[model samples]
Target: MADVVLQTINLTKEFTKRKGLSSPRHFFDKVTFTAVRDVDLTVERGEIFGLLGPNGAGKTTLTKMLCTLMLPSGGSATINGYDIVRQQNQVKRSIALISSEERSFYWRLTGRENLKFFAALYGLSGRAARSRIDEVLELIGMAAAADRRFQEYSTGMKQRMALARGLLADPEIFFMDEPTKGLDPVATRQLHDFIRDELVRQGKTVVLATHHLAEAEQVCDRIGIMSNGEMKACGCVSDLVGEASLIEYFHLLIEESRLEQ
Candidate 1:
């Protein structure tokens, strides 16, 4: 059997609804939304696994639950054999989340300063933090602009900084949500190359959540297609594609999901 680095067994998340603050029964109101339901998935060590879904497909919510950033309503997960709920700290230490959102960083801080600050949060300090920060800057090809303020950097550079922050802890698994969102084709290709050539080569297991079928096909070893809070299909890229193109296969699965619902 492959070395499974991440596994979720029927993991589920539901949010209870509340009425307006003026209503007396608002506190008692209990409508609910199931964002993720019975999601059973496995990611092998040192492979890029893609979770492909449209917007609001519960990809982010599932990621948050696995990362221990959000609590699951049912089921459980393990990261490198550590239970996510019972061993939250161990799970957190073993993974990193790279989101496309640039607002997560302090706009006033320089690229290096932002990285240094985040590195400090991960417990590295002084010379050690500086060394790691420098190494990451070089890794992302941002050494030349390390001193530039974050707001001054273009969208591509900001994305690189986000990647740097995620790499500061040197986690074993990386969870990336739409890493190339809103990027020009050139920038997107650059990020894709970095991910495959550098990160994968360095032996990190990556779990990528993206809506771009072609990009996922290019980078993922295996992919799970999610729709409306459920996984419709999962397999190696070739298996998933077969005679159909990835986009065609994706649309077929999505249509099937709609009919099932």
Candidate 2:
């Protein structure tokens, strides 16, 4: 049997939006927005599972819930056999999150310095931290440039540094949200190759939340198509698209979701 590293059952998230703070009646009245609804999925160890969706489609929301960054309003999930809610710390220890936000790092710090700081947060210090930081820097092909300030690096280099930081924990699973968001074509392809050739080779499962259809088809072993905060379809690219192009099928799924709503 395949080792299921991550699983979710009816996992959902809802946010309450208040109409107006000025009015007493409006204060009591709230509109609920379901960011993710009844999302059921499974990701096996060492396989790339893509959450393919456009912005506001709840891919990031779901990823956040799984990473234990945000609490789920309903349902449940597990990471590496630990419940995400009850065993939050264990779940966090087993997973690393890499987001597209470039501002999360200290701009004044050099790449190696940034990694060293984060490594301390993960409880690594002294020679161990240095050795691990060196390993990940080399793994991300940032060894030579590790001493450069983060603000001076190119967009692609910044993203690679983010990847390096994620690897510091040496977690079993990685949650990457729009990792290739601002990259040009060449950079995006290079990142994709690094994900497939390097990360997977290290026996890590990746939960990639991305809007890029081509990226999903190329990097994912299996995909879950999410629209309007729900999973519309899931399977291998060949199975999900069949005779139709992935773009065509994606549009079809979105339209069908709209009609259902």
Candidate 3:
């Protein structure tokens, strides 16, 4: 087996109810919501692993926990051998998260400027930052619109630019949450090709969290299906689903689960 670049053992997250301003405590009355529940997963180096689920199935929450954007309420995870909590700095340095949310970027800055700024955060300066920024923009096919104000860019363009920013640090592990959310067919195919080709050539491990079953089957080496904050099934597309498409397998599994419930 290839080296495990990312792993999570019983990883979980819980969101407690907010407390109103009161003299006495509301901890007893607080309701806890489990966003992710005991998710165990592994990703090998240079592999494309797809995390597939319907919306609100805890896909994004699991990614956030692995990437260190949000702390896991319980259990543990490691990225490139660094603990997500104790070794946060090392974990952060080794991974990049490309979320679908466009609001994370500075709307006033041009696409190039945004990359440059984020590159600086990773300690790249002077020629190093400029070169890296340009390289990523070209890779994402955003070079022509690199100077356009982010706010003025189309939704697809903004998503592309966000992807460029995520690669600025050249991290070992890439976590993408619905990366092709706003892209057209051509752009989506292009992004998928780039991810499977260029990034794979570089031996980067990608954890793609998306609900697109066909897209996952096309690009991922292995797929893990999630539902109601739990992992339902996991394996290679060929072995797990056989001749049937992923959608068919997924529906079968969902129906089985519903019957059990």
Candidate 4:
């Protein structure tokens, strides 16, 4: 009975190696790699939740499942209390998905052109979509470069543009994975400001997945650390950190995970 925007119940995903030269043809090797397993995560309404972990800790996989990019092998999840497996369409509409340097959008198109296309897809057309695009551009300080080709845009600009696409739908939930991955300190600060200020001010729920424990500690009201497809702990920064400084706390958190079998 939690006022949660996102929740997962024993969620799991498993992949099998298809070894071509194995004994069996189309070898379905008994080897099972669990990318994510038995994870129980909850994001409260109007809070920025952090999914903290190192690379290959399955943060991206978890984000993808939440955003409906992939199906989990077991358990159930809900977005806005709409079952992800059942009411997927509704879930998709309410969720904004962003990732770092993976699948994105038209590099050939101008920044404005790109936003226009997504706005149309989200059913915002003509004046309404234009208005929204302008709003986000101004919010992200990309108004001046709105007409520039995405290929010519800086890394930070591209990140902001990807974020704008997510906002075009006016979604209530945002799933961002390593959003500030390749940016410099200044750009990272700017992106952090948007997530911490703009998103929170609007009462949006965010689930941020990143390796930067320092930033996560600063922004997340609560954090969950994962390793080898399982979550180690989940709680507020002060709750987990206790006497240690934020930097000291992150090392302790990581060390705790590494100690687990």
Question: For this target, which candidate reaches the highest TM-score against the unseen true structure?
Answer: 2
Worst 10 residues of 2 by lDDT: 252-261
Give Cα distance to truth, residue 84, candidate 1, Å.
1.4
Clashes of 2: 0
What digit string (tens of lDDT, one per residue) describes model 3 on residues 1-261?
Answer: 669998899999999875555424773476678889998998899999999987777899999888778999999998899999999999999998988898999999988888888989999999999999889888888899999899999888888887788788889988999999878998889889989999999999999998888888899999999987889888887877785666876776566556644
- Tell how far residue 225 is off in model 4, in angstroms: 0.4
* Candidate 4 C-alpha error for residue 232, in Å: 0.6
Error of 1 at 88 (Å): 1.5
For model 2, what is the error of residue 199's alpha carbon versus the real structure, in angstroms, after optimal superposition? 1.3
TM-scores for every predicted model: 0.92, 0.94, 0.90, 0.91
Better of 2 and 4 by lDDT: 2
Q: Local distance difference test, per candidate?
A: 0.89, 0.91, 0.87, 0.87
Question: Candidate 2, which segments miss by more than 4 Å at Cα?
Answer: 21-27, 243-245, 253-261
Cα lDDT tens digits, model 2, 1-261, are 989999999999999877677577778788888999999999999999999986678998999899888999999999999999999999989999999999989999999999999999998999999999999998889999999999999999999999999999899999999999999999899989988998889889999999889899999999999998999888887787785577987877667666756
In terms of lDDT, which candidate is strongest? Answer: 2
lDDT of 4 by residue, 121-225 (tens): 888998999999999998888999999988998888899899988888889999989898889999889888888999999999999998888888888899988
TM-score of 2: 0.94
Which regions of candidate 4 are displaced past 4 Å?
22-28, 243-261
Q: Flag clash pairs in model 2.
A: none
TM-score of 4: 0.91
